[model samples]
Target: MKQTIPGLIAAIMALSSCSQRTTTTNHVKVKENPVNTKVTEQALDKGLFATLKIKNEFKTGEPVKLKFTVYNSTDSVKEFCKWHTPFEPLMSKYLEIKEANGEEAAYQGPMAKRMMPPPASSYQKINPGDSLSVDVDLLKGYAVQKPGRYTLSYTGQGMSGLVVKDSVVFHILP
Candidate 1:
């Protein structure tokens, strides 16, 4: 009976320790701070403008939504291949994300090192005074996992020169 009691006590201690570790590892403590929405815009060399918008606060483990828009003010049409945008190939050539510590987010997927002949239909043509917008979940699209402040920048270009470039900031909560 004495041996049984000691064994039971040891089992309880082990279980308690395991539970504590699990809770400690799973619970993410976030620092509370007042944040404001960050929005920025920049005009490219051409008559194009780029805008970036992001929320000030975010919940930990939740996807961060990023909104990017490109506006063309020129009288002619602006054309870009699918590889240059985040449409099908999901390329990030123009988009850049950096953590608060200035560490840039690494590109998560395979990047095209060389230009390939894309299908004719893969080209997106924007008419004059038109705009193109993209909504992306930063977590799934960019592998943003930690809860902290992040900066996002976008540099869009056409076959010519620079089209648009802008940057914004956002925060992730616990």
Candidate 2:
């Protein structure tokens, strides 16, 4: 019988490819947690010298640390400049991140006019009580997945207009 109609059409194409591979593996293990549960905590001390600390609480896939401090406390040398070159330096450009129904965590790579380079300059000198520290890992430049509350602001501009702002309030648990 024609090999029983090609073995019943190969058993209905192997049961429709095993039910579409178990519905695409159950839709990729169903993951949904775009942060939302009504929570608020605001803290800001708008730059005057420099200080931005982050890490209130985190444990949902970890990795979000930012600690920047730049204070010369005046009385002599205090020169810091960098025309362009930021994918780090605490990710400046007046960094600001907000999430908790306010969105804005989409700075996810390849756009900074395409990794800037052409017009450049650089300098750094903080003396007389000195202070210049930087540590950043905010998921390698934002796009902070799921979890919860987050607000981080930074204003670090040096040279002639010397300014350094700070703000932090973070929490991400699951």
Candidate 3:
């Protein structure tokens, strides 16, 4: 019986330690203030990720489509996160719009590298293993525009403690 007592105590100690094991999710923690508050809300949702792609181009007044893929890894889809204008000045500083002939174009409202609030018609959703695409023109509805490379960057936060960022590079040509 004494032998059994030690064995039982050993089993109890092992089981108690197992309870202390913690499950930590693999995600990047955002220590700094978010560029947008919506990022904080989205970071709580699972399976939320954004994919960005940029194409090199050399034409002005042409379409410069920006595509984003929002996907959910879990079965439930949440709309806690929304697209907001980026506050980072660097986000605007990196975009360079030159003429097709290699001349600098006139400065417009916000630079291309900055993030813009989604238009009124903008609503993005993602389901489990599903992704969506967004397209925007380089200089929507413009003419006599310059041709040059354009860079874009977007930041997003997921509810699952995931922060995603994407950068794109495009150019305008004659």
Question: Best lDDT goes to which candidate?
Answer: 1
User: What is the clash count of model 1?
Assistant: 0
Q: Candidate 2, which ten residues in sequence have the lowest lDDT sum?
A: 18-27
Please give the RMSD to the true structure for each candidate, in Å: 23.8, 23.1, 17.5
Query: What's the candidate order when arranged by decreasing TM-score?
Result: 1, 3, 2
Error of 2 at 79 (Å): 1.4
Error of 3 at 58 (Å): 4.0
What tens digits encode model 3's per-residue C-alpha lDDT throughout 69-135?
4544444443323323121221222233444355544434453431233332333444434455555
Q: What lDDT does candidate 2 reach at residue 46?
A: 14
How many collisions between residues are there in candidate 2? Answer: 1
Select the stronger candidate by TM-score from 2 and 3: 3
| Global lDDT of each candidate | 0.57, 0.51, 0.41
Model 3 earns a TM-score of 0.43
Per-candidate clashes, comma-separated: 0, 1, 22
User: Taking the tens digit of each residue's C-alpha lDDT, what string does model 1 give over 1-174?
Assistant: 989999998766543321100011222333221123322233333444445677888888877887656555555566555454554455545567899999987767655553333446656665565677787777755756777888887643442123334477888777
If both were scored by lDDT, which would come out higher, candidate 2 or candidate 3? 2
lDDT ranking from best candidate downward: 1, 2, 3
lDDT pick, better of 1 and 2:
1
Clashing residue pairs, backbone N/CA/C < 3 A, model 2: 47-165
For model 2, the stretches where C-alpha displacement exceeds 4 angstroms are 1-52, 58-67, 73-75, 82-110, 113-141, 148-171
